[model samples]
Target: MSKGTRRLAAGLMVSAGLMGGVVVGTQPAAAYPSNCHYGISSLGTVSAWCAGGSGSVRAVAGCEWFGWWTTAYGNWVNVNQGASHVSCPWPYGVRWGGFNARD
Candidate 1:
């Protein structure tokens, strides 16, 4: 192959490899924690506990008025060795709550 053609092919391969690495290394900002237990109450309380892992957990409450229109987020709790809890306090509406794990 010509030198110019070879250089172009090499540049293409390098760009492809770099792009692949970037994609593979990307991760979600929030994820479910491993070995963690979670629950939600009918009254819009959410809780979570991690038996293991070094991270933080928080509660998320989905509130509904006209529809599912608002979200109530709880404080971040360090769950490396303990539990986290949060509740939705919107009195005029119904709500569903869950948990999220943070790095």
Candidate 2:
């Protein structure tokens, strides 16, 4: 191949490599923490709530308990509730949980 053509090809390859590296190294904000709650408030808005090892909502204040009401406070109706993950009901609950990690 011509010298000028080869140099242009090499430059293109280097630029692609740099862009690929940057794209692969970055993480989205939604993928922040595992077992974190995310959704709207009681009045219907968006917020994020994280959970600790103790399994209680973390760093959230003045929020109502999600799912079920009255004397049966602890009871919930998550489609996939467990020690690892949970999915809340409507815009009135905790909504989503578990790691945002991709496999």
Candidate 3:
């Protein structure tokens, strides 16, 4: 290619790269409730309690069915309120549990 064409191509590529980086870097962060506590019960219950903050928190329970597939369930509660809980269905056992926060 000619020198001018090559320069134009390089400039376009650099501009595209910079724009891509800006888009990737400018993504919004996740909102989570502060001062939260979580737990998993032996009966396949997942719970979360948030004593402070402005967002909401939820309990996430990962349940296993037929010893093969796993599914997740969740329940939400506002911050500074009572606990939120999620439970697996019958014949499904708890594989894991955790909490999530949202605005």
Question: What lDDT score belongs to each candidate, Candidate 1 first?
Answer: 0.71, 0.41, 0.81
- Per-residue lDDT of model 3, residues 1-103, tens digit only: 9999999999999999999999888956645578888898877788888886677888887888877656665767888878889887777888888888888
Give one digit per residue, the lDDT tens place, for model 1 in 6-64.
99999999999999999999986654456777777676577777765667887676767
Better of 1 and 2 by TM-score: 1
Q: Tell me the spans in candidate 1 whose CA falls farther than 4 Å from its real position.
A: 1-32, 92-94
**Which lDDT value does model 2 have at 89?**
33
| Runs in model 3 lying further than 4 Å from the true structure | 1-32
lDDT of 3: 0.81
TM-score of each: 0.54, 0.31, 0.61
For model 2, the superposed segments whose C-alpha errors exceed 4 Å read 30-103
- Predicted candidate 1, C-alpha RMSD: 8.1
Lowest-sum lDDT 10-residue window in model 2:
70-79
Candidate 3 has what TM-score? 0.61
Q: Candidates sorted by lDDT, descending order?
A: 3, 1, 2
Over 7-103, each residue of candidate 2 has an lDDT whose tens digit, in order, gives 9999999999999999998985443234555543454333344443222332221223554422111222221233222334343344322222211
Compute the lDDT for candidate 1: 0.71
